[model samples]
Target chain A: MISEDYDRIDATLRSTLRDVLGLSETRAAALDADTPLFGAMPELDSMAVAGLLTEIEERLGILIEDDEIDGEMLESYGALVRFVATKTRR
Target chain B: MLRFGPDQGPLVAVALPLFEDANRVRGFAVAICRALAARGVATVLPDLPGQGESLVPLENCGILDIADGFDCATKEAWNANRRLYGVALRSGALLDKLALLDGRWHFAPQDGPSVLRDLKRIKQASQPHIRLSDADWYFDLQAPADHPDPPVEIAGNLISTALLTDLSVYAPWTPADGGPVRIVRLDSDPAPADRHVPGTALWRRAEPGNDVTLARLLADDIADWIATCER
Candidate 1:
């Protein structure tokens, strides 16, 4: 079974990248929170970004409006998780 | 039809294949089957009529007919032993009867209307270089009897208008009447679920290629579920 840490936001985020972007566990974990995702990761192109957004909704059980996600929100893992946490709390 | 794992125990009935990009679906099925085999479970991945190396022409097939084909395959597997389970993915989930098996595992099941909408969108997106003389067949999701023949282009495959029309109206056949459904939606699955949600939709990764890592993960997930079900 894949190792899982459900409590940590970074753990969840990394796992999400592993599943969505098909990254290895090491590769996903290697990504720092400040690491840019949108423009940096070729896999995170426009379509992949849209998919990642929808997946964030499904995985977190939260609704994310289209207007809520901009390039800035996806700039880094920290930014994306912060946006998710805020939306989920709201 | 492809067989995987040890064929001794309950056979998994894989039904209602992806209408488009049959190869990608086939690849995932192979992975899932191997995973199941590792857990000592077997699966029968039937090539949907007229697709996936099937000799039948698309014009000769329809929605209900394909569902019936699934039934035949499922029953065949069950007949081998009195036990049966099911795994349906994406548009394949339209075959609700897969739920009737001893255990049910579903991934990203879409409703008929939504699938039709996506097809229409793809057709529209592939504009300017429209292939058909009477392109309404693409827009309306129907193949008029008079509007030419089989082998129309869709999602990188040549399909029949009759089959496409049948798919356009394909109804949502939920497994509500059967066992508890384990749902994992990576794509636009209209169905609800019970825990174990994946954080990504890798079914059709937009890199214009298949996602092997996610595919393996899903196979492991399904195999784990099958092992649990057997226990």
Candidate 2:
């Protein structure tokens, strides 16, 4: 994917996490490559993860198979964005 | 039933999203109803069978049963000589198909299969050890063939196996199958819609929340659409 497309995916992933997790604008804006997600974020429990994935799929128009989901894909902010970017490329 | 605005004139019946989304977006839906009322349009939010305060248990109700309840609500409005319009959110879009209405407005409407997919994901998330197949996740392999399948609990909602089966093939009512229909979606969603508004998916929020701005904007959209349909 082009840099512009990657940027868009990055932004969408950020907003998806923010909206689904109910994070504030500032907190969402501050998310970076190293920002831990999933287990680190209390709001992102297993149930919330389901909603987050669905919202991401709807917004990005990408289908993420159950097998595609793993700890590494959702390890941190960058990992999640990369996983979505890879899906979009497909 | 929660009634809003004046008793006369065209009425907009509101259908909250199915299951947990209904709880998450109830306040937002109500805000939209109140906003619509402020625009001189009356609206009603009814408790569909198997939902809300309805005495019917969800496990015993089929998809049609809830749709029937919605149809009955609109029939009452039609009997009173009131022009009826439907405003549904998410899976709520599936319920208004059986209602008697001049037009239907859906916001981020989700089809039956999509709803089932979300439920399945939630179930999987809650029980990672259990392997569930898309074909017959609700059925128990050990149970006798004649034994009735038990309800599956997902995200605190006990949904019937029959309903799950129905959802796999259930699609929202389109204009080809019904009266005039309008679809609106959030800007973030890439799905085709008549119009896309700037807002996050409130129904996706983990905690129940309200979006006053989104509600007001949607109310305006609904009011304008209803006016056009009335004409």
Candidate 3:
């Protein structure tokens, strides 16, 4: 994706995480490329993952297959954004 | 039923989203009702069968039963000589089809298959080792042939297999289906809607939450839409 599109996806991912997890604005804004998610974030338990992925798909206008989800894609903030960016590009 | 605003005017009955989303958005729905009351639009948030304060068990209730409960709520208002309008959030859209209302307003309405998909995902998330097929996820492969199919538990809700089957095909009422319908969606969603508003998806929150600003905005929208319908 282009730089502008990438930035938009990154912002969307941040907001999606905040909304789905009910995080504060400051916490959401603090997320960055290196910020670990999934197991690292206390709010992102297994059940929360389901809502998070569905919300991401709805907001990004993309479909996320069950198998496409794995620890690697959600390992960090940047990884999730890149995964979504790839899906949008497709 | 939780009643708000005036008692003798047109009534706007509200339906919370089904299942877990209903819990997540209950506070938000109440916020909207209170905001609508401030706008002088009466609203009622009812406990549908097998949901909220209702005594009925969810495992024993089907889509039609819940829909009938909603219909009954509107019928009570109709009997009292008041005009009725429906305001539903998320999967709540699927429950208002049988209600007699002058107009229907839906916020981020979810279709049946999509609701089922979310439930399935939640169920799968709770049990990573079990591969749940779409055909018979609630059934046990090793159980006796004559054994009764048991209810499946998803994220703490004990839901019946029959209800899941009904949700596979149930859909919200639309303008094309013979009614005045207004659909409002969050700006992030790309789905077709009569209007798009700036807001996060409150129902997506893992815990129950409220968005007072979005509630006020939607209340204003619903009030304005109801006025136009009355005209």
Candidate 4:
């Protein structure tokens, strides 16, 4: 049940990434679970990252701290999905 | 007595932002207040003590002291039809701690100084300056014969380390309400000029040009906040 819930959340996240970051379908799909978002996309600089985090929090009802984020955590879409799941659990 | 229309304007209180600079609302504060006012609520946008046209010098005030002054201002103005919703743009979000001042809120954190710096870094990798017109001046990385990679940097003791610290502490995603505070966040990517605050009925507007469009958008947002808070 939880995995199914995770999948739903994951799909929403992908859509959000596309909508908020203005990513094309192909570009967004090219992302895997552990891809590095910060350096990978020039658009994902600090401001975008901050905006992304805000979008995620509003969508998933999670709170994130600047210190809580790191390269590995935001590496990919799958990674972000897992991160959201973890945060939601808490 | 006069009857107002369904699209009647909101009740708004306007004042200068909290900063050493005399003009400009903080950032996200503009959005929050505008959203509220758009809903026919009542809101007030006050300038911090020692800033704006208030006659006090920026050097004479500290963060906490500024917060205190704002609090006092809100309380003195509170009335039956008025709800003090403090709006803080960018680093101004820290002033929400002074919400106890008005006990009413509609906070938003727009692309503040650090975020602006980060954008400039990504844009031209250079610092920014205030032009004679108070417009944020930037170096054109594309001007050629310049350094590698586009970079725009904004420098000055005006944006103090203390100000940076205050801004960094705010997490726009989570309102002190433990939910998404009514907000509209602007993204630098693809440069969408407008945004919508999710979960809440509020709107988030984004636009390029730190001059007219930015200021106008903020003013619209503040107007909305005042409209909503009035209820």
Candidate 5:
């Protein structure tokens, strides 16, 4: 099981996705650690990536470099959550 | 569509349109002009090169050419006694990052990489992107501009390699050292401007999305903000 902190992060991530990607709350809640992004989610297009990063930066209070982003980090929900976790820890 | 009030008031030159129709909020740029006119604010809506009624060919246009249009739009405001304010929507907000710096409102400005990447994805082309300079970028191309076939269309916009090279590496947002930027982050901020009621994505392309009430509220909010800032 994930820690309570991760649960909160996941919750926050869900809300960010909803706001940036325009996903519904019900659709957002269904997403889990293994949920694939980019290809799987039609709404998370190239333009949405910019919007997503902006929202993530504001919501998590972390700064992400353009070079730091890769397909792997956005490959799955867990990958994104871990990325945020690592950034927050730093 | 350049709009001015009866009395000579502060002018808002909208630059760097987020999408095709600049200043289009629920088909309300004209409505916004009227609204701002009532509030004593003159507004100028300058069309990008190769856009709207402009006769410039789409393939001949570049980002610098677009910025030129922005410059001409704000010239009248610059000469005036009162300070000229700029309003850049979405990625167009990058205009504030450039030479055009007046009191401004940036409604969710987008970065350059995001724009380039989005351009690539819309065409479903997975070519590599290379950044040449701060405001230049390169995308891998299959052929030169004078290729056999005509210019290809991507995302409802005709584009060529020359255009792509010019639009490649624009990173507008920097660390705000108390600069002249006021971004109303619609996604993060709890302000009324960012409110997202269900089935109400006004910026959605597939659906006919128009929220008249919210548009009015947002226009009012923008007017109030500009009025306060100009004061």
Candidate 6:
């Protein structure tokens, strides 16, 4: 289970990727904190990406911007967590 | 042939729209499945013949065939569960209707005068795009004779007669159990009156295109819904 604190974002990310997407932990963890999700994960596509974004938004109570889709934030699980942390901080 | 996955709970079988293979399943269907799965509600998404990887020919596909296929898929795909929900998108009306309350959760959009706007755009576009299915029209609820024209910009400002005729008959499919049959509008905004209706979950955000806001909102909703349905 993920902790309520920001550190739990890792657990949240892992659980979502593994349980919801049925991805193996080895593959899921292979993602670096700064990797582009779409290009990195064969399972991630436009639709899946959209689904992930929505799930994240509703669960985290955050809003995403259209211009934010870049190679930086999506680079890795850590990257996404950092991005979420930045947004939550703001 | 349908795929089976050791159905246990009420089978939640989702029907993909025409020309939309498993790829489109990534968006809404996957969200719904994740939502249900979190609740321990097992879900199934089967690629109809001719579409997706099913290896069927396009010409051989029809609305009835899709619905029947959904039925066969549901029975064999899922183990006998007390409830079965069918979630269909833009063009999956017939299957949605045929699968009516087969004890399954059905997520669809409401058909009203507003849809004409979407159809008109499809008709007028210069490029050849996927034709909006008549299924949207089939679900339209008849507007009253006194019903005013829906705001011009509701869909895309090109409402047509066929589109009008279509919206008049649509009633969001209500199940026998009254358990929430979430009707979400894809690709359009809800009318002002629609905002106040209970059980009408509305989303007006434009496509997020991998943006942070889009991602955040989607993830939050998926997580919340997942949390909600799993329990």
Q: Point to the candidate with the largest TM-score.
A: 2
TM-score of 1: 0.61
Task: Provide i-RMS per model in Å.
Answer: 5.7, 1.0, 1.2, 9.5, 5.4, 11.1
DockQ of 2: 0.84
Chain B TM-score, model 3, reads 0.97
For B147-186, candidate 4 gives per-residue lDDT tens digits of: 4323322322233334333444443224455422445444
**Each model: TM-score of chain B?**
0.75, 0.97, 0.97, 0.46, 0.73, 0.51
Query: How would you encode candidate 5's per-residue C-alpha lDDT over B1-231 as one tens digit per residue?
Result: 455565476677766454442423425445555666766677776766666666777666666666676777677666675467777666676544443545666665566655665555444333326332223233335556576334446656776555565556764544363435556545444333333322233343433335555445556766887767666
- DockQ scores for all the models shown? 0.13, 0.84, 0.74, 0.05, 0.16, 0.03
- Please report, as a residue range, the 10-residue window in candidate 5 chain B with the lowest summed lDDT: B131-140
What is the lDDT of every predicted structure here? 0.63, 0.88, 0.89, 0.48, 0.61, 0.48
> For every candidate, how close is chain A to the native chain A in TM-score?
0.85, 0.95, 0.95, 0.83, 0.92, 0.74
Model 1 chain B worst lDDT window (10 residues): B128-137
How many backbone collisions does model 2 have? 0
Please provide, for model 3 over A1-90, each residue's C-alpha lDDT reduced to its tens digit, 9 standing for 90 to 100: 799999889888888888888789999999988899988999999888888888888888888877788889999998998889889998
TM-score of model 2 vs. true structure: 0.96
**Model 6 ranges off by over 4 Å:** A1-90, B1-7, B20-25, B77-82, B100-120, B127-172, B175-188, B191-231
Candidate 4 at B122: error in angstroms? 13
**Candidate 4 wrong stretches, greater than 4 Å:** A24-36, A54-68, B1-11, B14-61, B68-103, B107-231
Deviating ranges (above 4 Å) for candidate 2: none
**Global local distance difference test of model 1:** 0.63
Q: Candidate 2: what lDDT?
A: 0.88
Give the alpha carbon lDDT tens digit for every residue of B1-231 in model 6. 332233464555667544322343335555555555555556677776545566655444444555666776766534443456565654453355655344323233434322333333334232224333443522224566676443222222222343345455544455453554544332222232211222212121223111233323333443344345546
- The list of candidate 5 runs beyond 4 A from truth reads A1-5, A33-90, B2-7, B16-35, B76-83, B96-102, B123-153, B160-163, B166-181, B187-231
Models sorted by DockQ, best on top: 2, 3, 5, 1, 4, 6
lDDT of 1 by residue, B23-44 (tens): 5466666766776676677788
